[model samples]
Target chain A: MNFPSKLIEDAVNEISRLPGIGKKTALRLALHLLKQKESVSESLSQAILKMRTEVKYCAVCHNISDAEICGICASNKRDRSIICVVEEIPDVLAIENTAQYNGLYHVLGGVISPMHGVGPDELKIASLMKRIEEADAGVKEVILALPATMEGDTTSFYVTRLLSARGVKVSTIARGIPIGGELEYTDEVTLGRSILTRVNYSAE
Target chain B: MNFPSKLIEDAVNEISRLPGIGKKTALRLALHLLKQKESVSESLSQAILKMRTEVKYCAVCHNISDAEICGICASNKRDRSIICVVEEIPDVLAIENTAQYNGLYHVLGGVISPMHGVGPDELKIASLMKRIEEADAGVKEVILALPATMEGDTTSFYVTRLLSARGVKVSTIARGIPIGGELEYTDEVTLGRSILTRVNYSAE
Candidate 1:
């Protein structure tokens, strides 16, 4: 309402559309951008643009990447025998920051939230199963690092049942992470501890 | 170390550069962008790019605009005779949000801060003085709407001395605003009250 400029107003509005960024915070961020040198703002804008234009989902692991395979999937140092499954790319970053895990990762895109209309058909579960069954026989484990939500638990159970049918070692990352704690907020020490304490999941 | 893609890493790193956005939060925002439809991220990115590319400062009032003069300076409905000086464009927005003030504004760009090496020359003080001294004779009241910080007080005193010597009615928004409070953070009611009870400067 009667903002300083149309461009600024539009910019603030667009930023406010971002999750967790309100109008007041958007205004503060926009003003901060306006105050910086033109090059800084220009670079920031370009980086955001590049993220949309260049990044894509790694076809193999469903992780975000600029190519067919994500860096984690491409890395020779990581143990291909173990694949840590998570709900999103940020979960990959959370695990990576720990500097303790030397295993590969697979992003599930999302958990099975029937309430949100998300089912196995919409997820990358089929591809995950195929990858595990088809990988060279060195594959030893498939770790479910999904959030400890009900939906995450349901998805993990279904995956374990399916993967176990193929005789692959199935495990869920430890429940040491708080029941409601988001992977994005957990610190490296706690996350590493949880990873180290992974538990086995067997079909009842 | 082994971030998925250069573009994704660059975007996350750029976002992390913002105040209070840590590496984890940056990664979270980047992942959110990746999750959105391509068009949504592209549009938001383009909006930021356009803001940096097309937005410019109003030569007359120092507020950001797409043209040479800001809307407040060009609007015939606004009282150009009364110039309300503020530290930033957000301050102008704060005042305008009330819809009670009819006066135009002058943005100082920043207040005087010795610790930050910001002084009179760093701000738009000279341009403001030129507008007052050489503009139409209708120009009368010059209200200082600066923050209540030590730097804000110093800047106000400095600007008041400069304008007072030129035989103009120089005033400052009252001290009702809590000390050390920023204009951007104050409520409209408090700011309006401060404006209504502005104190006139006199020779000691």
Candidate 2:
């Protein structure tokens, strides 16, 4: 598209470089920002610059943090004996938002995917082992909270083998039909797995 | 959602302030930026700040520009006898992309919307009149390229009435079925107008 101004063109180009945003969307955003007060763009740019330049990663869990250790890893109230292993930082946020898990998180960065040239060595697998093996940390169980894809399963199995040999119980989150899912529309593999892992009737 | 870091939270909040972006999408964008090189974020922020702070508007048509007069208005190659009136800057860009018209453009900033407290005085209608009234510009025709909405029509009628009194011909873009649109699914009003204003067939 022919941009009226070089500044707008530059802004739109930079914005469209972001994942999921296209040139049209970037142009829309640039126009919206132009219509808003100068302070709005000022704050937005300042926030992004500050976040990118000053953002820290948790030394223990590799999660984005403001300090050397993340809040979850530093908190005494959380279940320190169990670590919920996730494939990325967003997954940690997703699980945290659920409010179902009280344990700390270990961000693996990514799962093993040979197609993508990503192996166990490319992820934070070594750091996870180091955390679990720490004498005073007392980590007992390692929960694999990766996706349901083959890469996720492979990473889960790989982590499980390593943790099992290190004398820690290894488990994965249950695979089942979603809460509001209908049996008729449920995919075959998920339905089959849910049936195979059916639990005894226990009123909670 | 619980953000892992305050920096991420602030960046997400600022980003979500943009039109059509939500909290989750903002988080996703922020995380994507975090994963990319720090220089990427730096360039993005720099571009946004530069665009917002240094952007200029055309003195003649009120379109976004780098100089006092926009490239379109400054170009002698463009047809000087006719001007296409549009609702916003993006409309000018859209028409330019079509490459169908060689006339100049006058962006009205927005249409007259009483509900939104917008009126003709809020638009660049006066400047448009002044441009036509100029002795040497020789502008003879004003094309209403506004949307088919009530506000757009109202603004069109108002502008046409003013330009008509000045002895300048006023016309509107044809209302018709879209080029790829099927007649079976065409809306009644557009179809009705398309049939009413049918043009004579030309072999070419």
Q: Which candidate is the best by TM-score?
A: 2
- The C-alpha lDDT values of all candidates are 0.84, 0.93
Over 4 Å off, model 2: A202-204, B202-204
**Model 1 CAPRI rating:** medium
Q: On residues B102-167, what C-alpha lDDT tens digit does candidate 2 reach at each position?
A: 999999999999999998899999999988998395887889999999999999999999998999
Q: Judged by lDDT, which candidate is best?
A: 2
Q: What does DockQ come to for candidate 1?
A: 0.54
TM-score of each: 0.82, 0.97
Docking class of 2: high
Error of 2 at B76 (Å): 1.3
TM-score of 2: 0.97
